[model samples]
Target: MINGRDPRIDFFRGLALIFIFWDHVPGNPFAQLTVRNYGFSDAAEIFVFLAGYAAVLAYGRIALRDGFVVACVRILRRAWVLYVVHIFLLTLLMGIVFVANNHVETRDMIQEMGLSYFVRNPQQALADELLLRFKPNLTDPLPLYILLLLALPLILPWMLRRTEYVVGLSVALYLMVPLFGWNLSAYEGGVWYFNPVAWQLLFVLGGACAIRGQRPSAPQPRPLKQQPLFIVCATYVVISGLITLSWKWPGLHEMLIPKAISDLLYPISKTDLSPARLLHFLALAYCAAKLLPTGQAWLNNWPAQQTCRMGRYSLEVFCLSVLLAPLADMANALAGDTWPMQVFTALLGLGLMMLMASGLELNKRLGTPGRVVAV
Candidate 1:
């Protein structure tokens, strides 16, 4: 913990931001290195879960320091800020896509980024945008988060009082998604890219964990290696990694895998947070939580420090990444997607993200002067 706040949260959030940037750039060779290439759930899961975890911790601190009223106001205000950022970011992204498309020769940037609807039907697109349903590629997360935060005021009191009950309710709501086909509408006759109804379970679980940590009466987790659950989680993570990696070698994968299992797992929908994907992410989270000590020496190293900085200024870093992705794609495209350009652009993108983070840290310190900044 740094200043009574968990450094691991920021570290993992920052890592997820890097993965998200690499994953978004079309045809970027670094995409192969991202967690998505070898897992059922990717950076999106980390982003959402940690958003909840950090949000609840922050909210709890505020409620204790001020009151429930102040905490509610802060949460609502945050949702509003995210809403405004989403609007401006969408506008800026659309403009960037147009400019990038005009310059790039390899592919149509508009179609590639799924912005063709906005181009064809500007009026309807604007209407949908106002309603938070016209999100293009790379913009789904913020909108989902806005909805989740908006609902927090309604549930936060209950969550603070009885976290386990709230979590149980969240799980029930998640189950209702598949049964009732619950989802929010999207712009072009489709549902949301990240389904809020199904994804809220992770958000709530993250909050529950935060609440548990703050309660003095809550039981501490058992030593991981001594627990049977640790072995089960470790075994599942390894087996799933192998199964995911098998897709790279189609011939061997086809020969080794049974058709029955493949058929069952074929349509693991990220839209609705499929059970298989959810379970895999849970197992993965369990293993990570158990194995990675929070305050390891390596975590305080220079590289890790920079990542933690990025995590601290995640909103700014995330917006920068959304903008940088298109530019990275254009650079690689103009350079003919050579290995050198791929490596350069990938490294350069991360460097830029770190720079933005560092700048934000300096700004925050200058703004606060002697006041202690919350983690």
Candidate 2:
């Protein structure tokens, strides 16, 4: 059976990218309301996790048809393409911003365009971005994806071939968030905005689900007649309520686990990883997967499919937004807290991204959405 693209997943991806862009836009009211804020509930985790999940669903077929070695090589090359795109866009943004801010002599502009200009300064303000010494931060998504892609060889291997290992490791990693807070210092705050070790677990979970034909985590499934949609909605509400109560009644966090595991439930100072937050995230992810998709034919209409198209090309879209984000930030700063301007910036950014991706796809370049071709 052919496992064609699922419109729901694609639409979800597009929605994530939209929120991601809005979240980065200054003064977005939805920023705090969305899941990307404090702890594991952020959009980053969901996106990255889904990325892994999607990779397995789309590329595992190629891996099965080709050889694992060939598949792994292809994945690495694809990752390198992402890295190049990131650098190319970063250079463009930096150059444009610098020129806008100052009167650059022709010679100075040429000199700034040189790769050395961006890479030479060890202590420069953007040294973290250039050297990859620290994570790209909320300033951009490049650094986060870069790390995840870099480590894919190690993680993806087991996930693709060894089903049990993948599930076990994902759980262990998720559990570790509470046992030992994620160490941003270990990665040199290089990937500060996204914690690969902790966040990878979500992707692994998504991957596992996709690999199993989009089944629930467990083998046992209740019949639709018995599994009421109301139950799923209730589960989500109860989880949200608990998360809210935990915040209001700080003491409720203690009740999240047995006394032995209680220590793992609190936030580690100066880091985003905490079991308490992970609990809420897992709950949210579960609820979303259950509630979304009712096998409706019209749900995948042309307009709805566009959202998935946005998602299918999310990395490219997000990269474009990152390049324009600073510009949006500046626009917002100058325009004051105006929602109209924010909306304008978002539309412009997303349009440019779509155009860029269209160009890339036309040329058969990276970021084109399709199944990976095995060597």
Candidate 3:
């Protein structure tokens, strides 16, 4: 952990960011290998959970040292910055898609991007965009994250005092979503792609973990075989993996997952953060934590170092990823969507993302003149 910022978190975050970029490009073959292929949860879960973990760790310190008011202001300011970036990114995306639509003969980029609304109703679209409602493709997570950060001030104090209570409250709110259809408003009379009411539980759980991490160390953990909870988590992870992989073959999926069980777990909604999805993520996280120690030698390698740099400068890297996704899709489409072209675009995009990360690190080292504080 450099400067009290865990490289493990950054490494995982960077890995998830790469997954998000791949998943954003619809029909990209590389996306078939992402986390979603192995479980009910996807990279978005990791992104939101880590966002909460990082936000609380960064701002909670200010709450202790500078006072709660200062921390609240700082959190709000960061949220506002995210909101602005979302708007600006959306604007650029629309323009890029518009130009690409004309250039790409195989696909209609604007239609694929869900930008038809903006084309038809410019005035209303602009209004909704300002109100945080007009979310096109590849733009959902930022808005979801912005709202999560906005609400941090309210529960953050309670989180510092009693993280359990905050988690309980968050759980209660999440439960109400399925019971009462609670959700935030979105563009064109639809609810948010990511329901904040349901997702807050993950965010809160992440913050709870962060707060717990700040306390003194507990006893050394038991071995994997000796830990019953770890065993259960590991089993669930394996079961979920087989089930998720079975989805690739409909006959196998049906044979492997019986109607009785399928009925029980069907319609697993990412929008509402369904219970099965949540459990799968928690189980996956538990197994990953138990199996992978933070200080492994592999984590110090060249690829890992680049990924860690991408994680350290996550916001900028994420923005570049958002912009790069559709462009990568276009590039592949231009090459007739062949396997070779698909792999090329995917690798090229990752390389560009890594390059941007290294450039940012270099700029920070040369331009900044103070102690490197964790963001």
Candidate 4:
């Protein structure tokens, strides 16, 4: 585990990054195995939640020790770095897709990935991109993260003092989104795929969890296990799992569910973070925390340690995954979409990601010796 960092968070974030890679490669067959198939929430939820949790652990501590202004400056500086990385990644992704489109007669990769607007209206799209308004398919999450980081300073102080108020305001904004049709506009006239207004609730919830020292890897009171809330959370998880499995077997689903309940939960709105999705994720998180208590030995083992390493360098790994996704798609196209090909691509892609993480870790270790020698 990274020094002073929670191993569980790193492991989950790394796992989520792997899942995100699989999900991005549509029709890879491995997509069926990711969290989305078993629940209303997907890797996106995990990614955003952990991001908030980490942000608080990192920046909130700075605010508490240093002044709020110093913490705000640091947060804004990090946001600026993410912004720069995003623009660079966007340019590189477009270039890769453009080249891939030229060679292959597959569907226009440009339009399919939502970069056609750049070609059609370069000036406007460029302006929108600079303003963080023009996000393509896989590019949406970064901008959302950057925006959340930018807004962190405004709420960090309040969150430190009156956590309930901050969370309440986040929830209020989330509820208002569906109620009032509120959303930030994208270039070419559409709303963001992961609407920040609704998604911020998870981020803030993560922050609150971190601030209260309630991470999955933290010790909890024994009474928590015996609480009525624990039973409810477990029951909800089981019910949700059954419901998700029904999607795979329609007849079984029909036999199990009443028409009224099915109708009410139909079209589980992911963009809006509907109550069903939110509650399901919360239940899953509760189960995870209960099952994997603080300082679990298994988490420090080989595979989990590698995953944690990846999580420590999430920004680099995530950007690399985004860049690698189209190439994976191209490989899928070339290698025939059989089960074997899908599995091969998934393993190969994930293995490469792990290798990259390991390389980064090695570089850090090797560089340390030189610094020590210099000192």
Give the TM-score of each candidate.
0.94, 0.72, 0.96, 0.92
Residue lDDT tens for model 2, 237-343? 56555554466566766566456644544343213445444555566666666656547575657556556667877877777776576666666546764888876
lDDT of 2: 0.61
What C-alpha lDDT do the candidate models reach, one value each? 0.88, 0.61, 0.88, 0.86
- Backbone Cα, N, C clashes tallied per candidate: 0, 7, 0, 0
lDDT of 1 by residue, 239-266 (tens): 7788889889998789877999889887
RMSD of candidate 4 to the truth, in angstroms, is 3.1
Candidate 1 Cα errors over 4 Å, as ranges:
1-3, 215-223, 371-375
| RMSD of each candidate relative to the true structure | 3.0, 7.5, 3.0, 3.1
Ranking 1 against 3 by TM-score, winner: 3
Instruction: State in Å the error of residue 173, model 1.
Output: 0.8
Off by over 4 Å in 4: 1-4, 214-225, 369-375
Per the 3 Å backbone cut-off, how many clashing residue pairs does candidate 3 have?
0
lDDT of 3 by residue, 1-375 (tens): 102455678988999989999998877888988999999999999988888889988888889888899999999999999988998999988888887788799878898898999999999999999998989988888998999999999998999998889998899999998899999888888999899999989999888878877676766577688889998998998999999989889999998888999999989999999999999999988788768785757697998988888988889889999899889888878888888888888899999999999999988887778857666
Worst 10 residues of 2 by lDDT: 104-113
lDDT tens digits, residue span 78-180, model 4: 9999999999999999988888777656567788888889999989999999998888779888999999999999998898888899999999999898789
